[model samples]
Target: MFSAAAALLAGAAAQPAGAEEETGSGHAVVRPVSGVSPLPADCGEPPIDGYVLNPNAEVLPTVATDPNRPWHLVTVYQQDRWNRYGSNGAVTAVSDDYGKTWRQSDNLPPFSRCNGGTAANGGDYEVTTDNWVTITPSGAAIAASLSLSRTGETTAILVSRSGDGGRTWDAPATLARDDNAQFFNDRPVVTADPYHPGVVYAVWDRVDATDAGWTQPVYLAKSTDDGRTWTTSKVYDFPDNSGVIGTQLVPLADGTLLIGMHHETDTTAATQVIRSTDGGATWSQPTLNVPAPFAVGVRIPDPDNSGDPIRNASLPLLAARPGTGVVSAVWQSQAADGTFHIDYAQSKDAGLTWSSPVRIDKTPVGSAAVPVVAASPNGTVAVTYYDFRNNTADPATLPTDVWAVTCKSNCTQPASWREQHIEGPFDARKVPLTSAGRLVGDYSGLVSVGRSAFTAVYGVATGDSANPVDIHSAIFTG
Candidate 1:
């Protein structure tokens, strides 16, 4: 089933084009894009309710475009998501026409049974999560995910390479793995070096238990020869009772690697960054970027589902401006009224010194969640997030909308940013309900297409039980 569906969706065949509309913010156009890779009915093992669960759902998309070829875009997302956990596997979709169309890839290294995983191939995990993709300077595309067993016995970080655009992928290379439940790995993010052609990096958190308490060490894997093989090491480890997650690598043009992470202790939480000047050999102590007021890590109470909470997070997203040392970060922060707002901050000296955080979400009445940031070559910084401003009072339905804000100059100024509607007013309540809550995704994808444009890939609800959520793409131009 997986092979057949992959073959069907693997080419230049176009998915339905969404309506085109112009935004009031003077943006050129807002074009919605959809993928053709819907999960098959039988996507292999770990069946749910006597059949594959959420067969038509796709979520947690990550998009990257080639620098040499801007029109060549690739997005990796989870397909056939389960209610409580991960999807059947991670899949890739390639768009050569600047996201006007896409080709879905079926060869993702078989991280789960749905994609042909087996115990002998080191991909026998029951599910796969945290799908991330990056394009190296040499035009090689790399996809990474956290594959784990159903019984929590094994967790591994695996990456696959696409020498072509993203049309096909090679078998995965395991960067790091843990067979014991005591040491679990989570939230793996892969990054390709913008300055080096064949150098790639993968970072994640390894949660370990000890006599003192729980500790999470940030692990780094370097593949100098593209994504063929990797050397893993512990770059930074939090103290006892403290751990870090959502680690993202921001490689600068000057050979410095900056890792942005969400650090949490028993009583405190903050967003921090660790720098590696001489590659991944050693990392400096973390420098605090922003302090999280609330410990709200990912899951929030769903107004519609009392038993389930929305899988949202305030995870910091850091992006470096192309050909510049300036880096910007964005994350959602909870307010006194229990509503979440998008916050923005910038670092001029490569994550060493950060400006004060500023609220960026324009909608005053509702909460915002899952913010993603990107910086263009022309020094324009943009962010995309979902908000509940359009939601009604009805408990049975939660109307949500996607929005994007672009800053041309000083992003630190609240008035310098202009907000534009990307897509939405779709009922989030109609999406698949998971144990974590209504499923959208932990994060979305926003990548700069050129000097004044960006392509955002996000998840939306379809209101159909057979296909509740879909991965969507939108092109925004200034």
Candidate 2:
């Protein structure tokens, strides 16, 4: 069920007792499950009514949780069965028992007209991608996604908010709409203000602003009334029509906000951080912390990678340390051996500077991609990723398994972290192909539920035709 590369990774490593590996920090335990748990069937199915089904994939899932009410969690993603460019529609899942159980609902807030009709039915492009969700201190849960018209001609950013603990959402709000059909919006992120309950910020990359080429112009939208009204404008513009991606937002404790993204210009790639003092109204020049370009994509040797393209490539994720301005960022990096692994760095002074990057994944062979990091209230840093290391058969077809690492504190040192096996070995081959390639997802979701426990949501193959790709939730209590 795996591609050629994944089977090879599993074959390279031996499955020690319980798949546990002893690291410098602690014992890394690979907990076994009876295959992946099923997500709500109603929520996992896409509404691909009229369009011809391509390699319909349920990918790019993200999650948000209530800090005050750890039991309340929400996740949103795309159900793209028709085409890779457009999803059937955006789907939402809600969990009230701290991710133990989930329910699917398309009761999204009402949407505005984009090109022809409502944003959902805008054009032939008919897909939604890169959706994100956040819960404010006031219990208002908000979500954002990028909508493209038929044939992927035009793009727009849409938003929905819920005031009743994510049970019911208000009308959808249009944060940013492309004036020119040639322009595109990618990977919009939503973040709630840490200091203010009603304040929220949404940021995304807009391409082709000045010239015909795609330029990376970061746009910001602020909602002061908990998603009632909005002000949208460009916050930072890169020199030339240079390219950038991976938009990340984090609201600091002192009323300021920090945005992180990967900036690519010419032949070089680097990590960039820009800050705003007065909300999202203005920003400073991006500070280049890491000099190396984010790895393009990993090669999973055995499977015919020709058709399977990684959904979201070379995107950086950020997590703020508890009780301090220090923040840690993780992204996929190609090692000297030509294998992809997770890399980490931290900025102690509120995104001003970063430490040297260090590799986190312990797999000696194969590739690891799509990493997400989260910091607990007690300063425990947890990182989750999927790798092919567990598929040990000689001509391995077993799929990728989810792995995690945790550090009590001072996680910057690679030796201080302990790796743990979460779940996997499902048939990655069962996941259908998209225009972007075989899609497990662009990214997975991880959130700190309590002081020591963490809840994660990720996509895995169910080996069934009804739903080729399914999203499952797991909890890590170490």
User: Best by TM-score, which number?
Assistant: 1
lDDT of candidate 2 over 1-478, digit per residue (tens): 1232222222342322110112213332221111222222332224344434533356667888876666667887655444445455666767654565566542653322211225354322345667789988877789887876545566788787877545566656777777566688888899887577788889898876555455788888988887767889887887775767778889877665788888876567877778878777778776545765443443334333344444436478888865578787888777665566788887778777778889888775678877898887778888889877765554425467888888886777999788887777876766755554456666888887776667777877777766667667777754
TM-scores for candidates 1 onward, in order: 0.90, 0.83
lDDT of 1 by residue, 245-363 (tens): 89999899778788888888888888787888889788888764577866744565455544545666547789999877799988778788677888888888877778888998897
Whole-model Cα lDDT of every candidate shown, in order? 0.77, 0.67
With candidate 1 superimposed using the best TM-score fit, by how many Å does residue 138's alpha carbon deviate from the native?
1.6
- What lDDT does candidate 1 reach at residue 434? 70
